[model samples]
Target: MSALPNTHEVLLRNLNLVEGRPALLGVSDAGLLPECPVPGLAMTEHAGLWQSLAGDTVWEGCYGYEPEPSQGGSYDTVVVFLPKARAEFELRLALARYLAAPGAVLLVIGEKKEGIAGAIKQFSAVAGDVVKVDSARHCQVWSGRNVDALSRFRLADWLDWSRVDCAGVELSVAGLPGVFSVGRLDDGTRLLLETLAESPLTADRVLDFACGAGVIGAWLHGFRRVSGGSPIRVDGIEVQAQAVFSARQTYLNAGVSGDIFAADGLAAIKESWPAVVSNPPFHSGVKTDTSMTEQFLSQVARHLAPGGELRLVANSFLPYEALIRRYVGPVEKLAQNRRFTVYRAVRKTLG
Candidate 1:
């Protein structure tokens, strides 16, 4: 039972959500990602939301664009959803400013507590005043005309976030402004990475699921390279291009050979000789989002060969042991602190 029960099912019923030939920006789980057989023309976000949330069946669009494809659309209107971050919403609106033609309209929809008003003010340059859509379910819609447009020049603030290093490694992290644990390492994540210092996937292909800023990935790579173990390779899977970019920089900075994909790389992951590692994402806003982590647990078991392991760190209080038990056998706790718990599970049999 998902929070958005039939999230996929509901998405299918909303085929009429999009209208005419407008290019849609800020399409995430709630807005777009067609559940209906017929896909929308286009979407924008950290990465390919349509493919994961719904499926590849609705693949009728351009995706994963950097400086994203804002301009060049013949679209008379651009629908912009107020994303989670005010700063991110600002950049997205700034990008859309150039895309909308003169007199064109920008439609924004979001939850009231998510700060949609601040977005309206940020985009005032390429627009007029605020116009709210129907207010239902605590969500509101608003619009503005392209009366004016302004360059934020704050592009780097939302895009070029970094982290302060502790321990032995000082790695760079790229993050979109509004993302969870943006611009730094999570307390739990840092604890997990520090504990896993003794374990390295020597000469094995390693996948860092939900890799943010490539912290865990680079940490492992650096230690293994120094230990002189078979030159182990790294691969990361993240849903955000910004996070992917930061992870890629970690690889580049390490001068190590690895792949970091913005796509949902964890979904298709199937490696016979590999080690799967993660500090999986388990929360969305104030709510718990176990979908990605559950999928990651299942996939980790599927990807590892005989004796292969899935090492993970999670909040100590979460009932992850049950989820881990569902996919892996003989699950064992490795370590624990007041805030976090680490586990090592072996892929005993084919699920």
Candidate 2:
């Protein structure tokens, strides 16, 4: 186990505000429940965090914005550990308000480096009369009243949609706050799609690993339709709840249907795919963490059907070539520019 995150540190210092049962949203797995005065509902959308807990306290692994109540009922206090995106912050604020009981308090805690100071302004908008309660370990805690709003949170209402041209077909994309490359296509994905367009893969099912907003999957569906190939099914796996919703909307908006659900990496995938295309996420929060992508590369081969292919795009600086060769099979560089490189690996079949 690692040291407690700074946000949890701030949470520990202000335990006095936790009146009645509380809801700890966006919680990490630092084993902090042992010290808390009351055992609150420890909730996190993150798959990694949700699975890391020891079941010492009540845990809720939510996949969507709306949080459900525990057996004890709605919370008297809702503690939100500020997310990495401002859009997500607002979403959490709205969600916290919806989850708390009448006259319940809302607490926001985060490190300064994670933009906790700027969030105080937004927190005040939803949680009126917000005040800084504590500042320690480079983290701050703010408390306020949870006021009911005029509007309810609909996940569709928060989506940011955009259109992109791929493989001679127009595709729609939907993204929520905190999702990677939301509202616009990123250059790396553009390069990967361009490469795929030059040589399309024919498969009944394709796995878009870490599929952010279903960009790659939607494009492939459109590409196949335009080329007069058999209709292809798209399977997307995303860890973030917002991205899962965004990807589902993206596929729906594109008039292409398949499955898009939340999962921590490939842990939930059982069926092998004929092809897997991804521009996998490289960052875990604000830091550049490639462990997820590396793990995907290491385990993806086993999840591929015989003669299946894995295609992905990544920054040129990252060392993924060795990992791919070591785990998947022989690798081939498909395309490259100054910033990104696309690679392909085919799973070997026994004679």
Candidate 3:
């Protein structure tokens, strides 16, 4: 197998043999459980990571926002593998406060590059006292005790909601901490919307792949209604459980109906569609990687009907054009600005 992540290695090294079971939060597949096998819950939001720990006890939270108690009992220890997003870090800290037993020791581990010191500082707000227990492999492990009452931080209080207007459409977007571009619309998405308006693309069934906050799907639903087009069905697939929740709320706020599922890319989707549109995520944590987007481009053709099209907006610097041609079919640039490019690729029909 592969090596353990630096943060996980540091965490394992510094963790003392505690008396009771410990909860593991945001621990990726590369992270191994303690050799003694604690009975507490191992939780993650990434479906890919959750599936990797198959046969192991793992709980998949909807967007990595909430934590469920183990066997309905409070945990004596809570260990958090810090996330790159500040909002997500705070959310997990809140979970730590909610699930941790009074005076329970909360352990947090993270790479310095991801701001371990800042995380420790944030932990101090809710924790009684936070201190670095160990530092190695460029990662630091901090420990604190839960002194605040559970009722102080509610799950609903962690969500950040706001109204955003995109291309004259007002959106009631609900963003869970750490979800991308949470309460506001991003520039890339705005560019995609502009291209969608000018393009000749029309479909009765559509897939909003990587549908963060369900903005694209909601906008499509509203556009069709105002344009006097036939009623359309939209389905969204997102990797983050929180994004899936936000997408559902976005649809509700817009008075539209759509099916949204939390999945690892298109792994959970089975149906072929006439159109697929996305402003796909290219970052995993603090690393800029195209593996997820590349995987989608390489396999997306199998999920598209003949003559169906895949329209996506991406960073102008990304080499998606070549990948699109290799797997999907001929691709054309629909629009381009200073930083973003929109492309449309049609699936070739077989004779």
Candidate 3, residue 59: the lDDT equals 38
lDDT of 2 by residue, 1-351 (tens): 667788887788788989888888787654777677776677676756665553444544454474443422277888999988877888777778777776788999988898999999998887779999898998889999877632355667788788898558788788888888887889999999999889788778889998988998889888888888999898998887778888888888887768986778886678788898889888877789999999898789878888899899999999999898887778999999999999998887633
lDDT tens readout by residue for model 3, 218-335:
8877777777777778889887767877778778778766688778977667889999998998887767899999999877888999999999999999999999988889999988
By descending lDDT, how would the candidates be arranged? 2, 3, 1
Question: What lDDT does the true structure give each of the candidates?
Answer: 0.64, 0.81, 0.78
Q: When superposed on Cα atoms, how far off is each prediction in RMSD?
A: 4.7, 2.5, 2.3
Locate the minimum summed-lDDT window of 10 residues in model 3.
Answer: 54-63
> Deviation in angstroms for 116 in model 3?
1.3
Highest lDDT among the candidates is held by which one?
A: 2
Please provide, for model 1 over 1-351, each residue's C-alpha lDDT reduced to its tens digit, 9 standing for 90 to 100: 234322223323333443445555666554444333343345545465645533445443444334333444344566676666676676667655655565666777667787766666766645777666456556666667756654333334455647546456566665665555777778887777766665544436777788877777777766665556666777888886556665776578677567887766455555544577888877775588887787767666766777787788998988889888888767888778898988887777763
